[model samples]
Structure formats: C-alpha cells, structure tokens
Target chain A: MTTPTSGNPRAGGGPDATGKHGRAGERGGAGRGREGDHPGQPGGAPRSLATRQAELVEALTRAKPVPEGFDAVKVAAARVALLRKRAGEVARQWPMLAAGFGDRWKASFSSWAATQPTQGSLRDGWDFARDLDGRGELPAIAGAELAEREARWSYDGSAAPRTRRGPAVRSAAGTFAVQVAGHVRIVRLSYAGTRSRKPST
Target chain B: MGAAVAVAETAYGVGIGWRPEISGFVAGLPGLRFAEVVAESVHAHGDLPDGLPALLDRGVAVVPHGVRLSLGGAEPVDPARVTHLATVAARLRAPLVSEHIAFVRAAGVEAGHLLPIPRSFEAVDAVVANVARTTAELPVPLALEPIAALFDWPDDELSEADFLTEILDRTGALLLLDVANVYANARNRGEDPLDLLNKLPLDRVAYVHVAGGAEHQGLYHDTHTDAVPQEVLDLVTELCARHRPPALILERDGDYPPAPELTAELDAIAAAAGYPAITT
Candidate 1:
C-alpha cells in the first residue's frame, strides 16, 4: 500500500497457487532480482520449468555423492558464477533503476508463469528432470535465445538449458542449435526445423 | 494512413487516465475533466509533465493513449510506435485518441500483455485494417479499449460485442468504455453482466473507464485494486444511463484511495446517472 511507484502485487507474499485466481492479484510483477553479482539481471519474471524442477529436486535431496565433476553445466556455472562477480556493481546501477513497472512488472511475470504446473521443485535434484519435464511438455520460455536468435517470450524455461545443439540434441528433439554458451530457448518442441536436432533423448 | 477512423461524436465522461503513475496525482487534481496521456508513459517521461499543456489548458481533455500499439501486430503498427503516438496526439490537443482492443507486438516480441485477438474475419479484418490505418495517421477519436480475457476464441468468429461492432462498424473509431473491462468479462465468463451489457454498442461510448477490481483467489483481478465495485458502480451507473458519457474516470492503479474515496465512487456514479452535480 505504499505509493509514488510501489506496484504492490500485495507487496510480494501470498499468490502461488497457480490459477483460477490463484493470484492474478497482479501488481507490477516480472521479478528476478536475487542472483545479483553483475550483468546477471534476468528475473523480471521467468522461473517455471516447475519452479526450476522444484529447485533441482530439493538440491538433489540433500545429497553428496556425484562429486567427481558435478555437472548440469557445473550446477548452472555455480548458479551464475556469483553474477559474474557483480559485473562492476551492475554496470554502475542499472540505468538508475529503470523507473519501475519495467514493462508492467515484466507483464505480471508472464501472467504469473501461466498459472504454473508441469511439475515443481523450483530444483534440488530436479525430480528426475521433473518427471521428464512433466512427461514431455516442457518449453515455455521467458527469455533465452540461441541458434541465430529471435525468442524472448517466457512463462518459464525454468533456469533454461535443456539441450544445446543439433544432431537431434535429445529432450525429444528434431532440430535446435545453441550457438551461445546458453541463452537456450528450446522449449522441447520438435516440429523438426533447426536441421533435425538429435543427440540422445 | 491506415485508412480513416475519425468517429468523434463528442468525447465522453470521467476520462482522466494519464499514467506516469498518475503524473503527480494529475498535478494535484483540481478541476480534472479528461485525459488519456500515456503515449508510452509520456515517451518514458523524458519531459512533458511540467504543467502538462497548462494542465490541458485548464479544462483537461488531453488524449494520446497508446501502449505498444501492436494493433493486432505482425509488424505494421510500430512505425516508431506510431510516430511517437502521432507526436503525442499532436502536442496534446487530442480530442479522442485510444488503443488496446489488444495486441502488443509479437514475433519481434514485447508481450507486455494485451494479446488476445482471434475473433476472426481474419482477426476482424486485421483489427479493421489496423484501426483503419491508425485512424489515417493519428486522426483522433481512435478509441478501442475492451480487454479481460484469460483465453478464449481459439474461434467463435465474433461476439466480443460483434467483434467490437465490426471494429466500430468498419472503422469510424471511438469507445474507451472499459467499465472494469466489461465487469472483467462478465465475471470471468459466467456471463450476464447485463448480458454482456446487452451485447454492447452502448451508443458507441467515447470514454468512461472506471477501474478497480481484484478478487483473485476467486478469479477476479481486473486489478486496478480496491474501490469501484457496487457492482462496478452499478455498471458505471448503467453506462451513464445508457451512454450519455462524455468523460468520467476514477482508475487508480493500486490503492491510493481517499480522493474522498474516489469522490464517493464518483458520487455513486452520478447518483446512478441522474447526473446533476456537474461541478468539474
């Protein structure tokens, strides 16, 4: 209930039921802002491959086994290598906090990530890749594009990166390239285009 | 020129919608009459807030309302956001400009919400030829507004008030009438908000948006947030007693209530549209 630029969505607390008014109480949504280190700003809404596979299956169910090289792209590059060491104080204070309603709070976080669900764990061990991305329905992006670009639409690719390149790069692929280290925008689709993507489903 | 859209049958009631988050409470709200402003929050508020057009020449009236006019986008209406909202509705002499029958650019991406188009006749002849070529290059009375969809029309052909009365009877323009988005789509599709206000066409309403909706966990959210719901002030007091609206606004983006509770829900929508208290 604050004013002069508050955008309240009930000052961010309740509202995560996932529709039929689970919480369209919608106030300037589009969040992200926690991974702060530097040029790592991405959050103005985009989290749901079921909240990053229930945060990687509750951090792999508090486990400690596979230590030899710890993969999943080295745990998302140790969760974005501390925002690339605070990229020079977020490029000297991100254009004076880009005067709020950053596109209506990133368009109320893609209508609150399209009333969630495709399976959760926002990740711990990624519930066996969140039940194989809720039995193969993954791919709803928020921002992350690769292979010759053009994508940015998101509701949640969770913390992105599912497949990387072509030669049928798995998650049930037909074609999809990556080019970049990973602004990965696959959304598991396979209408068969990026020259038939395949590697191992 | 998109084709021609000047349907100005005199701009109508409680208009003031000027966002930049309420340009300093519309410069301390004294005799506010009409406003639509926005034009991308006044070109991202780079200027034009110092006594906005001398407070719209002390009678308000302002207009220029565009918010990423993807006018059913595919790549045709962003000529630099319609030449910066036709130079801010011709430096604000705006008699009736408007937008949002929905579409906020796609394929080039910018879904800052307001998508839902598909009613068909090729999406109402591509939003009536892009609002008749953007009202022939920003020629006012462009009104549009109606939004409140979760997602429907994967096709029914028409009936979002006959595809907005066939895009205002094939582009003549006008109708910002968002009585809380037609009571948030007849209470989210259960229908009968006066039978979708008797299948719309309230004499081609010119302006009268009255916001504030939120219920959410019950599926309400037209989210202008609290106040303005004695059934949306009896449906804007029955569309100002059947469209006599010439200007009327009480929008509030989120709780800032007490402008005497939005002038007592706009004096109970002008005493259920008996009108009288004309004190602007």
Candidate 2:
C-alpha cells in the first residue's frame, strides 16, 4: 500500500526506537495530559483525545476554527453534510414540521441546528418546533402537530418527554388538541389558511 | 448459564436491515434467515416493535447492530451504552452484536455520525480498551466494523489493514466487513480495493455489509440511502471468491425504493455472493 508522503508524523505518533507505537507526546500534544480521563472530570487539565475531539466536533458543527494541520474545506463540507443528514432525520420525526418549510426546510433547519449538537431526531425536531413556536413563526400545520404532541406528552426541553397520564389540552396558533385516557383528539382547527391541517395524533 | 442454551449462532443466506419505515417489506421476506436492527432504536425492557416480535416468533435470527457506543473514544466506553446494547442483544437472543471501530462523540459532544479513527497505535489502544469494557457486559460475541472516512487525519501511523488487524488480534473480536466502505475508501484514494481485501484477515469476518452510495463533489459517499451500485456488487463477488462470509446484509437507511426495487437489490447481493435469492 502506498503511503501519503505529505502526512505529518508529529500529528500522530511516529514509529520510535522501542518499536512501541503511539507515544502520546509525539502527537504534538494532541494526547498530552489526561489522556485516558473522561471529559470534564472535575479538574481543568485538558484530556488529550477528549479535548482535540471536541475541537474537531466544534469545527464540524459550529464552523469554529479548523485545528492545526487539518484541511479547512473538508471540515466545512462535513459540517454541511452532517446538518443535511440531521435535517433528513428530523424530517422523518416531524414530517409536518418539515413540510411546513417546503424547499427551504434544509436551509432553515441547518441555520438553527448548525451550532447545536444533535439531541437525537425526536428531540431535535421538538426543540426546533418549540423554538419556532416561541418566535411566533411556526406554520399552522406544524403548530397543530406540536400542539397534539404537547397534549400527549410533557417535555421540558432538557429531559425525555413523559406521557401525560391525565387529561391535557394544548393550543398553538389557533390549533387546539386534547388528550384524555391515553387518546388525543384535535378539538379545534387552526384558521391559518389552507396549510392548517389538524394532526392525527 | 447451565449447558449454554443452543442458540442460532450462524448467520446464513441473505438478510436485510430492519427499519421501522419498511418493516412490512422486511417482514415479507420469506427466505430471510437473519436480520439486523439498530440497537439504539430498540427499547430493551419494553415490547419489541410491531413486526419485530412476529419475526422473532418465526425463529428468525435478529442481530442487534449498535451505531453508537463510541468504542474508539479516548475515554473508557460508557457503561450505560454497553448495557443498553447488551440488553437489546439479550432481548432479541441475538447470536452476536456488532459496533463500529469509530467514535461517535468526544469531549461531551455528539458528532451525530461515525467519525474515522486515526490509524495510530494510541487509537488501537483506545479501541481495544473500550471493546474489552463492552465485551465484558455483552452475553454474545462482538464484531467491529471499520467505517467509511471522508477525510484522513495527519496523525495516521499504520496502514488501515495493520490498524484493524492489530485491534481484532488484541481484542479477539470478529470483523463486520463492509464492502461498500472498502469500495468508497479505495475509489476515493485511487487504490485497488482488492489490495485492502487481500490484506485483511478474511477468516475473522463474521458477516459483510452491502450498501449503496453516490458521488458528491468528487467523493463517493456511502450514504446507504441510494441503490446498491454495480461496483459494490462486483467487489462483493471478489470478496466471496477469497472467503465467503456466512452472511451478507443490505442496509438502506432512507430514500427507500418500492418493494420490487428492494427485492432486486437483495437478489443482486445474493447472486453476487452465490447465495440463493431470498427475495424469490
């Protein structure tokens, strides 16, 4: 196999005299202190792989600085690709929410999620829909979907949603949903134009 | 633990990935002796998904393929993730469990997808340590899959084959060889895909993965959302000639085609590997 001569030996550990591979110091401090410790383990001493991996992730997710000796364009492309994949997953979980954005869904979702790490598709869509609802910009169909979900489960943004045991009612942008005895019913239709379809929760 | 219950350990013939979106299509496969499910999507303690129980009822061997666990992370593998994987395996009575040799998160951040491991001895050490931690909790054997990398780190010290072989040797793990990944990595690097296949320890292969991909801006992305290309099928044929793995499964994540298209894809994989067409 042909090796890339352009590779920087210091970026990874170079083969040493002892025939042992991966000397932590040879990585140009990439795996310096706290090499085996979990991230944020009380002390501020930076964990090598953990810190560098975070920097790489930050660069990929937040358009932060590309780390030393890495290709900037590749990292940028990965960031966009990741956001696109996330958009597809979120679309699956929140079809109406994604349909509300139409052709602009990818762009709109990417803009909101580019900096945020994924909390899984269900939570990501829920969080995005909630953010839009807060901004008074949620489309009526998505509003109905959100309302139905809100009626059926209680989500605090930071925790997994718990099924609401008792009766509950939720409304968003004129859409109203009612959940009673483990079943949800749309009680009121939104008056927000032709796109306002009640969610079949 | 008495007498070690005789489980269906061998993955035979053709199989397809079980996705919730196409559960019906997967269930309709009469000849499917094996299937794999995303370990994370399964609820360990609750009832299995609608059709999964039916498949299990029919005695189909469903293997839990874990997409997370970050086994190659710098830190020790998370016990919760390993425990969840083990639970899923036991729930399904899986013959074995599989995870990637890649890390999905680091520094308290989730990357949302598998990221490549630098081919350095430190990485091998990290992977081996985590695999040991994970295998200790698993009731079944574990298989490690190498991932398709979009870019390489400047710190790579070992060839891909050596890096992977060393890990498997040290950990005594099985190999989940992905033909599509081999094709993508070779096509992108302008190397002979057969070279890597020749160098790998094919005898360690527990099973193989066949998937589809498309080129984007000069790079072939193994998206698994498209149709399996002819090149990937050809590589599958080449791999079988050297050493035919016990099972080869098709993985389609999204952009699912109709039943006929999917059946045709599965038939193509079976034909390439000289296995009977499960779709028929």
Candidate 3:
C-alpha cells in the first residue's frame, strides 16, 4: 500500500519519500501544513485543522460545493452512501416511520436527508415525520409514533428533547396519544389498519 | 496521552460483536472467549444488555468498542463522548477499548457514519492528538481501527500503510485490524490485500474484525449486513499466516439471519484463522 512518491509536500508522501519523516514531519506537517493557510484562521496563526474539517463536513452533509481538488464523482458517491447509512440509522429508531414507506424508505429518507445535517436518529426521524405531517403525507402509523413522541417529549428542532413534566395529549393523522406523568399511552389506533382491533395502550 | 502503561497480554480467540438483536445467538456460543459491544449503545449507569451480563458472569471479555469517538476529527475529541466511553469500559471491566481511526463528525455536524481522513501528515497529527485525549480518560488500553472508505481524500499526502503506521506509532495504541476492510479497500482500489498485511505492524494488532459487505455500483462496501465473502475469509487466512492477531471477531450490524447462519460465519472465521470454533 506504500506507493513510491516524489516526496513533494503538496502531492502525497510516503515513509521512504524524500520530504519529511518521523519527528520533524509530525511537527512541521502539523504546524505548517497547507491547511494552515486556510482563510478561516486568525492572525495568520497556523490555520486550525477545524476550518478545513468544517469545509469537508459542509460538502458532505449540507450539499455544499465539494471542496477544491476533490473528485466530484467520488464526493458525490460518498455523499450518497452517507445518506443511505443515515437512513438506516433513522429507520432503526423509527421503525414504523420506515415501515410506512416500506420499499420507498431508503429513497425517501435519502432524498429528505441530503440537505439535513443529522441531529441524531431520534430527532432526524422526528423532524422527517413532522415535515411529512406538514405536507399531509405522513402515514397513520408513523404519525401515531410521532404523536406519541411529541406528547412525551418537548423537541424544538434545536437541542436534545427534554421530558415533559406535565400530562400532555397530541394527535397526528387519525391516531391519538396521551402522556400522563411521563408515561405515554396511545388511545386511538386507526393507524396501520388496526382500526378493528380494540386499541391497547 | 498519559504515561504509557503496559498493555494486558491475553488470547481472546474467536468472538462476535454483541448486539441485543442477536444476543441470544452470541450467548449460546459454547467456547466464546471474548466479545465487543458498541460503546455508545450501552448505558454506563444501568444494567448491561440481557445476554451480556451472562457472558460477563461466565468471565468472558466484553470489550467496549466506541463507534462515535471521531478520533480523527480535526477538532478536539468531545470530552463527553470520552467520559461516556470510559464509564462503559469501567462498567464492563474491559481489558481494552476500541474505536475507529476515522471521524464521524466535524464542523458541528454529525456524519452518522465513519468518514475517512486524508492520508496526510495533518490528519495524522489530528488523529494522534485526539487519541491522546481519549487515552488519557480511558481506564484500559485503546485499539484504533481503520475504516473502509468509498472515496479517498484528494489531498492525501501518504499511503494507507504509512498513514496508519504513523498514527499507531505516535499514539502507541494497539490496532484492531479489520481483514474485511483490507479486502474492501484493496478490491476497491485494485491492490493486493496481502501487500497491506505485509507492511502493517501486525504485532501491535490486539484483535481483528471480519465483517461482510456487498458491491453496489462497482464499489465494494463494508456494509457488515451481507454475508462474509470468501475473499475476506481468505485474507483472514493470509493475515494469520503472517501474524495471527490475538482475536478475530465477527461483526454483523444488521439484516441478521437465523442463529445457525450466524454461527456458521463465526465458525468460518475461526477456521480461516486456524482457531478453535466457538460454536461447538
């Protein structure tokens, strides 16, 4: 895996390459690498690696322009793969939400999350359900799941959700949920075609 | 990192990654010696997952493997994550803790999956510094696992071997080598996985990971949800021929099959590594 290189700093380098190695390379590369010249650094102090990392993260998660010198095709591929993985994680957290779309879960989640930087799976699923709710596209079962979560916790789309201290009731689509003393009980079970079955909380 | 301490020497043999979904299967492994749990999934202050306590009660090694450390992130590793990992390790009484040499988040954004760092000196430094921060808080030895990436950073300034070796050397951390990753990266890049096995610091490998993957649109992904390809098991054989790692664990994240199927994969890894099967 060690490809011979010309040891040029800007190109790639290797263990046996001529440019730098060992202790000096660690110090010099860490302190004076090209990333040190990034525009976000202050006072011309060695540019923090944080700035370049932020740019890369932006490109990957926010659908921002790929950073210079990166292969657009590969970046796009990575982005798609990342979205797929996120979809899986969110699906695990919101099983019914995913089941609501069934075959379309991966595609639907990927498309929706392309521009959404993850707020973790819990919030990602919640936000997605709310978006569908606003659009009148949420399925009953998933809507019920969302209604339960909303009744139990207070999520403002910013910060982690906090437990509601008081009793709360919420509904979505045709499903209804009530939270008493932090314990949620679903009352109406019209979601997922379970209307005929007696609602079991 | 704090002062380097002597690492525990133990033979873990064949093991599996513990998930609640497949806990029953993992627990039933008759000769299992060690297992790994996702660090973030466990609660530090609460009871261990169902089968995990039984495994621990039988004196099995349950290593806390952290998936979200983002040790390669350019920013300082998050202290809260480090503390939680340390807590999990202490609770499990693990001999070692493992995390990836990749970043999962940056720029105040979560990537939700392991992302590769450039094979550049800058990245090496970032990883080394962050590893130092994490090791300082950990109660046990830390092993770093290199992730399989679908794409390489265009600004990479080193080869895979050099990048990984440099990080291991600087941090003095053990390697949690993934034979599946070696196969995935090599197959994706058209290189020989054996070449990497030859160049790596094999003695430093504390354990190994053998997972499954599938090809999608011409790229082989280390999905861990597919069956372990024969190609990867062959590489395990190749790696063992050079320097057998202390343990080899089967990693199956999702799309779990029946218990017999999972046992067969574990047995296959044991056979490939020339270790005794735990499934008996």
- Interface RMSD score of each model: 17.1, 15.7, 15.7
What is the per-residue lDDT of model 1 for residues B100-183, given as tens digits with 9 covering 90 to 100? 876643323223345456565666676777777777777555778877654443224577788888787787676777778788
Q: Rate the local accuracy (lDDT) of all candidates.
A: 0.49, 0.79, 0.79
Residue B259 Cα positional deviation in candidate 3, in Å, after optimal superposition: 1.2
Docking class of 3: acceptable
lDDT of 1 at B228: 70
- Model 3 residue runs over 4 Å out of place are A1-48, A183-185, A189-201, B1-8
lDDT of 1 at A134: 51
Model 2 DockQ reads 0.21
Each predicted complex: what DockQ? 0.01, 0.21, 0.24
Residue-wise C-alpha lDDT for candidate 1, range A1-201, written one tens digit per residue: 111112211111112112111222222233422342112224334332222222232222222122211244333322222122122122122211212224442332222222232122121112222333355522222111122122211122333223334332223212243433333335434343333223221
Give the clash count for model 2: 1
Clashing pairs in 3: A13-B157, A36-A47
Model 3, A42-65: lDDT tens per residue? Answer: 443544556556666777888987
* Pick by TM-score: 1 or 2, better one: 2
